[model samples]
Target: MPEPNKDEWEQIAKDYDEKWNYLHCIGALDSKHVQIRCPAGAGSLYYNYKGIYAIVLLALVAANYKFTLVDVGAYGKNSDGGTFERSEMGKRFESNKYAVPKDKELLPAMEIPYVIIADEAFPLKAYLMHPYSKAAITSDEEKVYNCRHSRARRTVENAFRILAGRWRIFLKPIETKPEIADLIVLASTCLHNMLRNTSTNISLFEGQIRMESEHIHGVANLEPIRRNFVREVAITRDKLKKYFVSDYGSASCPWQWHSIRKSRVAPRRVQYYLLNTRIRYNRPF
Candidate 1:
């Protein structure tokens, strides 16, 4: 099957922006292990952390739970980030082969390149965003960024869960050759996209839906936009964080503050959340 073209990616980005309240987001990338019996002459090549023999199915899922791009047949032993780097999709992205559209604004005067969101397993780059590492997140800004990023990135996981739920075959180890398993995975994703396109009311897997906020959300939050000196000072590295804690954004996520206040257990992550909550609620303690 042919890969999605540039126009298709742009359309997907528009859809994602609408659904996730995040602008300039093209897709969400993730991977899953598809269990298979060990192949002959390959002892540990397929062994993964789950203590099973498998192949990795790396995918870029759109906001609507459709699989826009997929790469299969990587060794299960590889980390998700490594598997992604070795995949054809990754190579193309690195080379700019797809010619993804030029940088666009997530908020007025705040320009950012179209990007794909991934979990902490992937590296942060110009075109891809991964959450702040729990170890390095020092301030409320990073904490809010991590929470918002993870919230949007969750769609890819939901897409895979919905696919696996619909196709029971993936739940069990397939006793087939690696090559055949790859074809099956490809076909399954194709069918998934087909069904999503044809049906309007398909029930998604039961998952938590975060409350939608009015503020523009994205990784571009780190970049300060300068329209005038006044607006420039207002839009700093923590512009997104400021919105999340502002009157309009703060009222939309009271649950976050309540949860943060009740949990004092530390490892710094909790402290980060508490700081964010305190700042958002205008309560220092």
Candidate 2:
């Protein structure tokens, strides 16, 4: 397997900023459980909260629907965040081992660190952004912030959908040992990216993206295990939220307020429905 070099990471972030109107997004992170038969004598170690025996496939996807990095074969019994913290990449990131680019400003006098987006299952680290807790979103600014955050973060979801669609093996339980299943999953992911790169047929992803914009699916909110452990992360999120409501940010998408009003949903749950509505309020974002 190839490592994601600094050049590739920078290019992914640049494309995300240009194509998704989400600036400085290095990647979107998420995990999926590859269903599998219980391993011999494992004693439910592979069983997950979803009541299935499986192995976890954690991936960081680039803006172009390619896998930037992947770690497979964690027991499904572990939470996504737990699997991530134990993954080699995750440990390296925590220890600052990767050649992450220097921090850049989102706007003049507003230096914001580049970040990866994830759902509430993950910790809100200095380099990561997750939606605000559903119970604490009390202001319109937070709502808009959540909307924009989810919008930008949906790339990984789409990537997973495309991946599973292309490789139906993931849709069914693989009757193999855990170690072999890991290799299968890795090979399938590599083929997925190969197909994406060599093919120009994007109709499948395009249609899926359109449907995603029209339907707002409910995401289960998993409370963080640790609270008040990362105050700087929260402060950074606040700054981004405030920016979303400012004239400079709104200038990129002047129609955002209209879109928000039309959606008429909670801030954390509004991004999907707000996309592609025929209200004629279009802007770059």
Candidate 3:
């Protein structure tokens, strides 16, 4: 058998990015889980809140909603923020060698932000942009930034929603090893990107994107354990009204996520996972 080379993977990443171009924007970053086939020795730790071996896929979606950098994976037990910390992208940035695409003259390479926007599950490091906690800053500027940021960050969640609805691979829990699980995810992402290129193909975003003037990406489900520990989870119905309405979900978050619970719904019962976070937005974090 022949060994795969770096160029092959790089091509995959490029093609993936092209597949996710929603409206000329490239690369939406979000973490998602794929249920595994189950490992013999893997403990409950491998089971995510989604009740599967959910590996963290740190991918970049294009403007058209095609995935580009479906290049790296992290343990399912890790949060988006934690996954980012240990990802190859993190190492590249830390070494200050993160590279931008400069191969095409027509699509000339532009040095955009090294990082992308994420939800409350992610920490507010220099590389990532998350919303502000409601208590962190109550100023008007903060409010405006939050609004704009949420708009941009919406892409991640939107992407995820589209993915789940279309693929349904993630709708169920996985039971495979972390590495093989990563391949399953990669194949799905690659398929998503390939189909995104042709408008004739029906995808998850088929009706969803048309509804909004500006399409945004979607976020993946959070671990049940980290839910209550996230400040955003701590917000009451009233706070949510104020916060989400004020675009608090967009800009200025050091917020925590609320853990998911087993409602009468079967999906709810299956959701159970946790990870140590870099930034704890609330107590017991």
Candidate 4:
């Protein structure tokens, strides 16, 4: 896929700020496991924790539910964070090769870098953001930040959902060599973007959908960054967290407070309900 230029990146950031209320966010980053028949002589290399053989499809999705960048054919044995660290896209991000826009003022006094939002499975970076751990969250500010982060990050999840829904080939283990499976996934993602650009009714499939191997654990197992850089990234996140609750920030929705309160009172039920709501209506809590 072609890389989004600086102008395109600015447009994506604007769309994300308007639609998800997250500022300076260029895209949502995540991965999906594309199940495939065991490769010849591969042994457990393709086996995931779920005991299935597959390859990973690591994707960076735009605010409009279209893929912006994808790294396919990673062994399922690798975690999403690990796959990303080794990907060509990841290298470019680390080296500033993509020329992601310079830090700009989010408000009059608060400047922040353009970032791609991801889930906890990925490492925190200056150019990437993730939510605080649920157990570590204490303040209402953190709670609101997590809520908004999840909301914006859902774009990639929904992109995958729509892709699988429209292309049912992802419904089952693809019966082909890993190489061929990679080609199939690449082709499908390209076609998905093409169809989304031309189709007016693509939102019909945006409803709740599920896929296998959707969850992964061990965020601590991902590669570590320099201690100083980690501190810088944490400070960046704290700034954004503070901004989310400020008057200058986008106004918080009533449902966000309601959901956060429910989370403190009945965490399990709230989680269950949120999952169901996302599946049923494709709406964020």
Name the lDDT of candidate 4. 0.81
Window of ten residues with lowest summed lDDT in model 1: 220-229
Clashes of each: 0, 0, 64, 1
Model 3 Cα shift for residue 243 (angstroms)? 22
TM-score of each: 0.75, 0.85, 0.57, 0.84
| Poorly placed runs, candidate 3 (over 4 Å) | 1-27, 49-52, 71-73, 101-115, 175-178, 201-205, 212-285
Which tens-of-lDDT digit does each residue in 1-285 have in candidate 1? 567778988888788656664456788999999999899999899999999999999999888878888999999999887998899999899899986898755455655567788875775566776655665557765666555566567678778888888898899998999999999999999998888779766454533322222232323222222221232422332444555555544554554454333432577888899899999999958
Q: Per the 3 Å backbone cut-off, how many clashing residue pairs does candidate 2 have?
A: 0
lDDT of 4 at 19: 71
lDDT (10s digit) by residue, model 3, range 1-285: 122244543453343333332111223467776556656776765567665665676765544566656654566777666776688765664565544332222112322233345566665544444555644545544444444445555555566667777777687765556676677777877777666666585543656564662332222232323222444332321232244333423233322121011111234334322222323434253
lDDT of 1 at 57: 92
- Residue-by-residue lDDT tens digits, candidate 4, 150-263: 778878988898889889999999999999999999999999999979987635556332221122111221232322244766878888887777776747444556655655
Q: What is the lDDT of residue 285 in candidate 4?
A: 61
In angstroms, what RMSD does candidate 3 have relative to the true structure?
Answer: 13.8
RMSD of each: 9.0, 6.6, 13.8, 7.2
**Candidate 2 TM-score to native:** 0.85
lDDT of each: 0.72, 0.79, 0.49, 0.81
lDDT of 3 at 224: 23
Local error of candidate 4 at residue 12 (angstroms):
0.6
